[model samples]
Target: MATASMADKAKAKADTLIDEAEIASSASAGDVQAELENLRRDIAALTQTLASFGSGKIKEAGMRASEIGAEAADASVQYAENARSSFLSAEQDLEAHIRNKPLQAIAIAAGVGFLAALLSRR
Candidate 1:
């Protein structure tokens, strides 16, 4: 009868330990679930922030490209104006030279024409 009582006491202690272990395991699972939820929220916030940052950078790059295009167009216009000015100046100088030496200019033209005809025949 005493041996039976000792075995019963041991069984009761094991049952209490099992119950405590089950309670601890359930509490740990709840804590893990809460941490996972927090992590999901953090990831969502980070993604939104990155998206906003990317859009801002793209907008800034577009504005910079537009500015560069405008600068290039302005430079092209200035270059065209300079070229026109140079062409007009050369034309005026040639006109002045022809006026100052009409006979010499006629001789030079005849020589150029003769040379051109020779080259064409070849």
Candidate 2:
């Protein structure tokens, strides 16, 4: 009789363990499904928002690009004007130098030509 009681106790314990394992598996599956549903909801919301903003987003981007292009063009024009002014100033200085010292200018030119010939020989 004692042996039979022991066997019954062991069987009860095994049944309890199986029930606990099944409960745990079911709970985990339920949690996973809930998470997947939540993710789907979030993705759907984002898709809707993006669709609504499509045209407005593109127009905003285009306006920003145009502003940047205009700024760049203005900067280019200013740079060109500055370069022209600098070139004219340099020309004026050269003219003044030539007018003030014709002989010195001739001498400098001759020296430059001599140096050029010497370098070419090498």
Count backbone overlaps in model 2. Answer: 0
Lowest-lDDT window of 10 residues in candidate 2? 23-32
Pairs of colliding residues, candidate 1: none
**lDDT of candidate 1 at residue 38, scale 0 to 100:** 100
lDDT of 2 by residue, 1-109 (tens): 9999999999999999999999887787779899999999999999999987997899999999999999999999999999999999999999999999999999999
Candidate 2 all-Cα RMSD: 8.3
Off by over 4 Å in 2: 1-49
Highest TM-score: give the candidate number. Answer: 1
What tens-digit string does per-residue lDDT give for candidate 1 at 87-120? 9999999999999999999999999999999999
lDDT of 1 at 52: 100
Question: CA lDDT, every prediction?
Answer: 0.98, 0.97
Q: What is the TM-score of candidate 2?
A: 0.58
Give the top-scoring candidate (lDDT).
Answer: 1
